[model samples]
Each structure stands twice: as structure tokens, then as C-alpha cells.
Target: MNTQTLEKLREKLHDNANILGNLLVETFHYIGLFAIGAVTAWAGALTCWEMLHQGTITVDDILLLFIYLELGAMVGIYFKTNHMPVRFLIYVGITALTRYLISDVSHHHRPDMGAVYISAAILLLALAVLVVRYASSRFPSSNTPQGANATDDPERAEP
Candidate 1:
């Protein structure tokens, strides 16, 4: 075969390889996401069952459920948009920290500095969420689609 024909064939092969690689990656990506969603749902269901068996709902249990809810929402949003919401993770962190703080205070007869530290951490996470929201709204990312959330795109996410 002539040099031009061989070059053309090589280019076509390269293009096809790239397409196949992208398809493979996308397939695995979706499968992993579905697995995560399933696990979250299963865990949440088990937690609910345990709560029902106990016959009493505690504050900690409610907070745990909220954490699970946030995780499920995060997973669903990521599955739908192909982007993770940073705010949901922050909300989870805040909820988890609040739960810990409450549990510690109730368990311990005397309050300690650890509780204060956890409160501070929750405040920081809340501030982070606010900052992210403000930045996304004030300066929409160029790579983000029109009318879409800028924060949803990792490229537009704050460092």
C-alpha cells in the first residue's frame, strides 16, 4: 500500500480506538454509580429496619437517616448529571458532626472542648457551602451549559 493509504488507515484506527476507549470508560462509570446507589439504598433500608425494631427513634438515629438521605440524593444527582454536588457532601459532613457532638454531650456528664471543636468544624463546612454557592452564582463557568448549575461541573468547582 502507498504511504498516503497507510496513513489514512492509521488515522481511522486511532479514531476508532479512542471511541471504543471512551465507550468502555463510560460503561464502567455508570456501572460503578449504579453499584454505589444500590449500596446506599440497602444500607438506608437496614438502618430503617433497625430503627423500627427498636420501636423508638432517637435524635442520633434521625441525624443518621439525614446523612443517608443526603448520600442518596448525591448519588442520584451524580447519576443523572454525571457530576457530583459538593454541597451535598458538605451537608453530610455537617450532619455527621452535629450528630457526633450531640451524642458526645449526652453521653458525657461534663462538656469538653471536643464538642466546641466539632461545632467549629460544622460551621466551617457550612461556610464552605455558602462560599461555593455564592461563587457559582456570581461567576458561572464557561464550560458549564447554559441554565445549568456551575457547581455541578468539576471543572468549575472551587479548589
Candidate 2:
């Protein structure tokens, strides 16, 4: 084919690909929602049973519950808003990792070095969370401004 024909064909292929990609994304989104519902129901049932039978809940168990809750909430938010809050996911990940470290510390007979390493990792993660929170607060997002827009600058509009 000639160059013009090839370009047109490529554009058509690109448009079709984009449409297919969007449809696949929507399908996966629905599948994810279904999976989240199933898993949340299962986890809620399990937690209730354990609470009733055990008569008490441990910190680790509570942490696990929070993880499940976060997962459910994240999925719900996606369904409602058609977007996921990445910051919330990061928080959930940090909580999960911290819970795992705490559980390991309580259950394991590892050496001091292992404990130190785990502590270091937790500290680093904590620092990361703090940095992200601070940066977001300071800069804000494009939709949300940190300060009022300048309306007194007509000359600056040309730039």
C-alpha cells in the first residue's frame, strides 16, 4: 500500500484498539467488583464467626479486618467514582506491612538483626507516607488550589 493508505489503516487500527481497550477495561472493572463483593462477604462471615467463637479479638485479627475493610472500601470507591485513590492504597499497604511485621515479631524467635531490619523497613515506609502526605498538602492538586487565583493581573494573561 501507499504511504497515505498505510497511515489511514494505522489510524483506523489505533481507534479500534482504543475502543477494544476501553471495553476490556470496563469488563475487568465489573469482574473486580464482583470479586470484591464475594471476598468481602466471605471475610465478614469469617470474622463474625471467629469473634463469636473466640470471645475476643487480637490486634492481628483487627489488622486483618482493617485490611479487608480497606479492600472493600477501595472497591466501593472505584464503583462509585470510577477511580481509585492511590493514597488510600498506599495507606492500606503500609498498614498491612506493619501488621505483618508486628505479628512476626510476636510469633517468631528470630535474632535481633531480623528485628532491626524489620524496624528499619517499617520506619522507611512510615517516612514515605509522611513525605507523600506533606507534599500533597503543600502543593495540593490541580483541581484544588492552595490559594486564591489572581484576578488582578490582566497584563500577565498574554504570557
Candidate 3:
């Protein structure tokens, strides 16, 4: 009935709304990640099966499978630590470019600039991965607010 009681009730209601919103967001996030992971794994399996049924699997097919695998791994890491490793993406890029190079060479009877460009891309991606690794280690994020890397000792990161 008093102004103080009314103010307390309003604050409580606001706090409850925020909690409910956060809970809903987290639930949806998990659901989406699970769905994506399941579908990617299924597709990878299906592709492998189709390749086997066709009676031949090339190196490019194998590399394509690795992309699917990396995607699944990225999803798993997200589920486990809620942090996506940038390195995984870089690895996928490298694999994809290598596959492109293989495809161009196999499809074209003669060596072309397309294959050369793909090779260059792969090299650049590999170097980018190394640079990212160096930077992360050299200037590691000591304060992980989410506590995801709580066990990671910055001192042990020194090579």
C-alpha cells in the first residue's frame, strides 16, 4: 500500500522478467546448436555412404568430409565450452582450398592459374592460422569473464 512496498514489488517483477528472458535465450541457444550439430553429422555420414556406394572415393571427397568433421567439431566445442575456436575455421578454410586445388587439377588436363590461386589461398590461410596462434599466446586474454579457460595457465602457454 505504501510507496516503498510498491517500489520493491516493481523491482522484483523486473528481476524476474530478466531471469526468465535469460533462461529462454539459453534454452534456444542449446536447441539450435544441437540441431545444427545433428544435421551436420548426419550429412557427413550420408555423404560417406554415397561415396562408398559409388565404388570410388577421391582425395577431394575425403577433404570435403574433413570440412564436415570440422563443422561438427566446432559445434561440439561450442557445446562444451561455449567458445568457438577460431583455429577450426581456419583449418576448414585450408582444407576447402586444398580440395579446390585438387578439383581444378583433376578436372583440367593442364595446369592453370585457378589451381595456382587456390594453392596461394591455402598458403595464406595456413599463415593466418599461425599468426592467430602467435598473437593469442603472446597476448593471451588473461581475464576470461565466462571462466571458460579457468584452468588454462598463461604461464604454461610459453613455449
Candidate 4:
């Protein structure tokens, strides 16, 4: 009822909430890792089955397989590094889009719309990758020491 009591109660609630949020995050992290492992296993098995039965792998099929591999790799990297490499994922997405465009264009008589859309997506993803790479290089992280001449770090050498 008193202001001091209320403040203490609020702090306690805040602490409790933080603990609960952290637990939820950890739970989701584990779930994500498990799902990734399961999907990777399934994809591997499916690829093997297709290879055994069909005796031949097509370009489109290989591209789809690569998508699955990228997804699994992304998950693995997240588990190991605790961070996702956006640039690498963009590359994967570009490849997937290109592969889709190629496959669909071959089968359809007029793939103008699909081709344009896929091409635009590929271009946008490429731009994103370029931007991220440029930003990362220009403004390096703490582990990366900027040259002395760099305006951001006065202590570093210019050359």
C-alpha cells in the first residue's frame, strides 16, 4: 500500500518477469535446435532415397537439396556461434531463387512474370549482401582494429 512497499513489489515483479523471459527464450532455443536436427535428418534420408530409387540427380533437385543443406547449416551455425551470418543466408536465398527461376522457366511457355519476380528478388538479396559486407568491413567490430587514420578510432594508425 505504501510507496516504498509498492516500489519493492514492482522491482520483485520485474525480476520475476526477466527470469521468466529468459527461461522462455532458452526453451525456444532448444526447440529450434531440435527442429533443425530433425529436419536435417529427414532431408538427408529423403535425398538418399531419391538417389537410390531414381539413380540420377537433376539440377533442380540438387538446388533444392542445397536449400535444405543451407537451412541445416544455418541452424548448426546458430547453435555453435549464437549468431546467424546474414550475408551467407542471403547468398543461399539468391541461389534458391535462381534455381527456382531456372526450373520454372524451362517448364513454362511464358515465364515472364515469374522470371521478373525471381530476378528482382535475387537482385534485392544481392544488394542486401553487398550492403552488409560493406558495412561490416568499413565499421569493423571490436575484434577488428581500425587503422589509425580512421576517424572513429583516434589511437589507430592511418596507414
Candidate 5:
């Protein structure tokens, strides 16, 4: 009887530990999401504030703001469908690369050949975004149940 009681106690302890582990993991996940959201918001605000202080909004500032916007959108999508869309990152990259080209042209009377490289990079990113969009529409997720999200692609799903 004593041995049976010990076994029961061990099983209960193991079950409780598993539950606690899950709770902790969930808590950390939420905390991380909140941090990403809060930081993106803060950065956007700072960018705006800097533009105000400068008394003019430069293309660079606008591009920076767009990056923040993309980050926020990525976080929001992750929260909603638990999926991270790579196309947003590609969009952000294209914008950033274009911004670099603009910066080169604006700051330098004779823009260096580097501008060509950046433009090429932007084109690549744009192509990547198109490919991702095409792939997503062409091959939809098969794992989605009725009323369930199909945003998380199998290639991107966590193990």
C-alpha cells in the first residue's frame, strides 16, 4: 500500500510539473510578443519625433517609419494566425534598398556605382515578394480545418 501511494504521488508530481512547464512557456511567449510590439511602436514614435525636430521629413525617415510599420504588421500577423509572413520582410528590404539608392543620389552629386548594386538588390527582393505571393496562392495549406487558420505554411511550421 505504501509503494502504491508513492507511485501515485510520483505520477501526480510529474503531471503537475508538465502543466507548470507549459504555463511558463506560454507566459514567455506572450511576453516576447508584447516586447516586439512595444519596441516597434516606440521606434515608430521616435522616428516621427525626430522628423518633427528636424522640421522636415526626409525620405530616409519615411523609409525608417515603413520598416517599423512592417515590423508591427509582422508581429500582428504572428499574433493573429501564429504565422510569420516572409513577404513583409521582403517588402521592407526592397524599401530599405531603394532608400539607400535615394540617399546616395541625394547626398552625392555623382552617385557611385554602388547605387546600381542596391537597385539590383531591390529588384531581387521585389521578385522574392512576388514569388512568395504566387506560391502562397498557388499552393494553399491543406492542414486547415473548417474555421481554422491556414496562414502557417507547412515549410514554415514549427516542429
Candidate 6:
């Protein structure tokens, strides 16, 4: 075959392979996100069921549900925008720490360094969330046009 013809055939094959690879990757990515969301919901439901079976809801149980909520929200955001919001993870951390601190204090009935440490961790996570929000607002991503806020773009608006 002529050199030009051979080059064209090679380019066509590469393009087709790239397209197939992208499709497969995207398909799996979506499937994985859906699975994560489903598992989070299932876990939350089981927690509720256990609470109901006990005929009482504790603060810890509620806090755990909130963590599941944040996880589901994070998964949903990632699925929709292909972007993970770091703030949600931080929120989860804060909630989990608060829950632990509460549980610890309630069980121990005494002030301890462990509670102090957990409180400090929660504060740090809260500060991290604030920093992230400030940075996001102050230095909007390149994907967003200048002077245009995320709210201006419905698709990019925070949930």
C-alpha cells in the first residue's frame, strides 16, 4: 500500500480505539457512582431500621444518618458534574467527629482530652470547609467565565 494510505488507515484505527476506550471508561464511571449512591442509601435505611426496632433515636444515630446523607450528596454531585466537592467530605468528617465526641462524653460522663481532641478536629474540618468555600468564590475556576458566578450558570450551581 502507498505510504499516505497506510498512515490514514493507522490514524483511523487509533481514533476508533480512543473513542471505544473513552466510552468504556465513561460507562464504568457512571456505574460506579450509581453503585456508591445506592450503597449509601441502603446503609442509611438500615440505620433507620435499627433505630426504629429499638423504638428510640439517639443523637448518634441521627449524626450517622447525616454522614450517609453527605456521602450520597457527594456521590450525586460527582455523578452529575464529574466533579467532587471537597466540602462535602469535610462536612462528613466534622459530623462524624461530633458524633464521636458526643458518644464519648455521654458514655464517660467526664471531661477528657479525647473529647477535646475530637472537638479540635471538628473545628479544623469546619475551617477547611470555610477555606474551600472562600477559595472557590474568590478564584472561580477557569471553566467559569470572568465576572460570571456559578449561580449564573444553572448547571454549575451548588446543590
**The candidate that achieves the highest TM-score relative to the unseen native structure:** 6
Model 5, span 1-159: residue lDDT tens:
699999999999999999999999879988999999999999899889989998998888898888889889888877876767787777778877887888889988687778878878888887887777777656665655545443445323322
* CA deviation > 4 Å runs, candidate 1: 147-159
Lowest lDDT 10-residue stretch of candidate 6: 150-159
The sequence of per-residue lDDT tens digits that candidate 6 reaches over residues 25-103 is 9999989998998999999999999999999999999999999998998887787667777888888899989989999
Error of 2 at 30 (Å): 1.9
TM-score of each: 0.88, 0.65, 0.84, 0.70, 0.78, 0.90
lDDT of 2 by residue, 84-147 (tens): 6565566677778778777887888564677677677768777876776666555555554346
Q: Please give the ranking of all candidate structures by TM-score, highest first, separated by commas.
A: 6, 1, 3, 5, 4, 2
Which scores better on TM-score, 3 or 4?
A: 3
Error of 6 at 39 (Å): 0.6
Report the C-alpha lDDT of model 3 over 7-115, residue by residue, as the tens digit.
9999999999999999999999999999999999898999899999999999988998999998898887778767777878888899988888778788887887877
Reference-based lDDT, residue 125, model 3 = 91
**lDDT scores of the candidates, listed in order:** 0.84, 0.71, 0.80, 0.75, 0.79, 0.85
Error of 1 at 38 (Å): 0.6
When summed lDDT is taken over every stretch of 10 residues in candidate 1, the lowest stretch is 150-159
Answer with 1 or 5, whichever has the higher lDDT.
Answer: 1
TM-score of 1: 0.88
With a 3 Å backbone cut-off (N, CA, C), the pairs that clash in candidate 5 are none
Q: Candidate 3: lDDT over CA atoms?
A: 0.80
Ranking by lDDT: 6, 1, 3, 5, 4, 2
* Model 2 lowest lDDT segment of ten: 150-159
